[model samples]
Target: MKNKKRARSYPVVQVLSKTVYLAIPVIILFIVVSWFSFSEIRKQNNLAVENTVNIYQTELGHRLSAITHFIQWTVVHDPILDGFVRENHMGDYRNASNELRLRVSDMQYSTGDEYQYFFYWDEKDIFFNASEIKVDYDTYKEIKEKIRSDVKSKEDPTGSFSWKPFSFGGKEFLYYMITYRHRTFACLVSMEDILSPLYSLNLGENGSISAISPDGEVFYKTKEGPAGIISSVYNRQLFPASKSLLPFSLAIDSRVLGNYGKLFVLQVIVFLAALMLSFIMAGYILVSYKKVILPIKMFSKSLSEMDSVSDGEGLDLTDSKIQELNQINEQFKNLIHEITRLRIDIYEAELDKNKFMIHFLQQQIKPHFYLNCLTTVDSMVSLGDIDAAKKMLMFTSKYFRYLFQVDMNTVPLINEVQHVEDYLSIQNMRLSRSTLYEADIPSECNSMEIPPLLLITFIENSVKHAVPPEGESLKIWIKCRMMNHNAMEIIICDNGQGFSRDVLTKIRNGEDMEEDGNHIGITNCIKRLGLLYDNNFKLLTENNKPRGAKITLRIPVNDK
Candidate 1:
């Protein structure tokens, strides 16, 4: 009869098994596709940023070079500049300077360059060819001095020049100076000519350009101030001795990348929605299989085997075509076999429980010894020395309190630290020696959780095994900090005799040693860690340099 039922149940199990195997590959394919898509998107985004930088850099370089070339042409060909220089009359020079300044300003206005629209020339103490405005003589002298120094030391005469602050029009200017020399002319061209080209060139929405003369004077700038640029030039080392090109950087107030970020956010929303839909469909399929399909299929197949059941013969449906359903039917037959085995297991489990109870009873002897020690403490309280008795009572209370607080398997790191402090306070009293405990815990991780008693146990062990002899002080240092976004580390180190080789070996192998009373605490700690966190919590015991011990516990931030 049992064999007949077993044969009848085989096909259903086989069918379910085959379906699971097929589903695994389908799930893997989905995950692979999603990962590849995300990776490709990220790569494209980075490439876009690099391309934008390169485009702006090239455009700015071309515009600047063109402006310099135009200035060289103007200085060589302009008849007004020639007339002013040859005549050397102040009135003629002033008229020529005004006219030339007007021309430069008109050119700038026509080209829509709003950064700069003025030109100036300084010879001795007089300013010439300025934009119809008289510049301060002292300001021009300062500008001239800076320009002269830069030109005299320049290794590359034709290159675009940058300068520090030099005076112009009573205000400081960071200017770019270009000197032009022809057969009959030698003159300096301020960065006024480039303002038109700079304004016309596209540098994205937030990008800017500031041209600085070799004398640290401002010649032309798309931005308002040179403080940011001055800081950059002074602090950052410039590369390539020939042409210096600073890449166009995105502005802090830019709204351009907001659109791209929004697109990425939209993609995330869609991906999550698709994943939720897939989970819902998968859950529905699983529910249908468990509630309606499997049972109905089993009942239908069982009806076909009624004839074989009545004939008192063993049926053979194990070879049915549906392999998974057949295996499930076989499992039903095996369940009866499992029931008989379970009876034998129950008997074995009872014997094992008895043995464990015996072991537990034997371990109760240690607590009995602790209780007797407490009685002695009570007697001491009855005597005159209340302080000594109070110390003993406090230590006993803390030791038992920690052991009894089993409800708190995990606690906030701050609570664990408090427990350590309580333990240390009692230990310090018991030893009657000054023990320094330095705690530097970051505020961010104060509320982060960790396994209870994990850190305190190590600290207690250090106080127990590493405290120096009479008349000597002990120091225990502790620091609790977050390693990154999702992990916190506790470092507890002491300065006393370090652990011996034999003790270190015992800890590594998870062995409990009977030689030292201190070993019991460490062993219990290891066991508790195993039960609470499995293999996730790490406890390391090592020797400190020269002498002493360092015990570090690293727990995952979200493990609890």
Candidate 2:
């Protein structure tokens, strides 16, 4: 016989490799999304810096413009500047200076000393600070000298009103001057004071703010030497007010964009961790398949090929890595061996039971029946009826011979009917009464085979129970016919008191009727029929219409 090839199992590595194949596109997608997110973060940071710089520029420009307007108005409207321009004598200067000093002192007292007010007279060659009496002598002298030197060395303004950048003690200030013929009025504003609100701004670790000149020189900065991919906003684009006045620019660092490097590092770490986990899980699955799933498949295949325990004596076995699976395999093999041994024991037990039942049936008819036959035969001989005695002896010999033929499991229907007739004749002669016996057996049914003594057992039951008192005659009917193509039916009935309800109920239910050693003939007949025909035969016992016990048997027959 040609053997069919078994299919190969799928490799676990190939299954795990599919996950790596799927991850390639996912990694690409992740990078693309992260790039867009980084770009958006940069753009938002730039916008925030631009907004902060613009706000600062607007406030500073507004303050400078207001101060300039107020100084110009006071110079044009007050009589102090007119006195300085028209009078040159020291007395006249002193009288006018006293009134001017009182007015300037009043102005300084009205507003905080955020500015230093100065006045200059070209003819008198007098350059002095009008509101300096309140300042410390040394500090005031230092500031006055620096301003005096710068004012003298400085070039004259190209316009009547002009702005200039001034530095004093490392602080930035804007110097404003107004020229009225021979007299000049000017004031100094500290740039640091104007920008003080932004000192507490929440710029990141590597972030800063700076005020720069148009020439790229830093006037003031919050932090020195700021580092990293810092994004900045220029004041020229958002706030143009500072362009004409020294063209200073405000700059704010957007440090949020610089933090992208840390974010990207975190993302890479997470991706690598996930990849490592996937590898571990794949390895686990492979180990489980080899140790658990593979062994189970082998066990199932072995079971499928097995026809019987004896035939499968050499079962395919493999040691599994798992202890529980090995134990189960051993237990399954032991169970098969146990089942094989139990089957032989059960078969021998059934054979012994059949032999014991047959032997009992053979012995059952001899004891009481032999004594009755002897009594009848003795009586016959005593009357000098020698021919009757010989007839009775011949019939008894045939009856005992038939009853003892335990080896003949089945006999032809005609032989069983003949044995029954002989038994009935003996009973009639012994009782000295004639019983009516009729047989309606067809020629076809006479050759049918049935269990030996099956029909006679029922007939004997009728003779024992249905034989009436001396006056009334007993009528026995035996009928046989073909029931179907493969079966025959036999019916035996007798006109007498029918079976009691208790006996009929026990018979129909197939309950034991031989518990008291009674009805052993009928019990043995049923057991022998079961042994011969199994379920293919049917037997029915019921009370006939009118008054009699009826026994019907349907037996399967071979064509021969």
Top candidate on lDDT is 2
lDDT of each: 0.57, 0.69
lDDT of 2: 0.69
**Backbone atom clashes (below 3 Å) for every candidate:** 44, 0
Q: What is the lDDT of residue 380 in candidate 2?
A: 83
What is candidate 2's TM-score against the reference? 0.42
Give the per-residue lDDT of model 2 (tens digit) for 1-560.
22221222334455457656666765676677577666666666566666666676666566566657767776667776666754367777777667766776766565546767777766677767766543456745655676556555556632345556666656667677775555667777677765676665556765666666656677776666354334342111223334533346666653545444556775775577567657766776786576458766877877777765454564555443334444555677787779889999989978876786667565557688889999889988999998988989999988888777745656788888889888988887788667889999998888787767677778878887784644889989999889787899889999888888988888778788877665667776776677677667788888887788889988898544
- Candidate 1 lDDT over 360-425, as tens digits, reads 334423565466657667667777778878777776676657646634446777777777786666
Against the true structure, what is each candidate's TM-score?
Answer: 0.49, 0.42
Off by over 4 Å in 1: 1-74, 102-122, 125-328, 331-372, 378-383, 386-460, 467-470, 474-488, 505-520, 556-560
Give the Å shift of residue 305 in candidate 2.
14
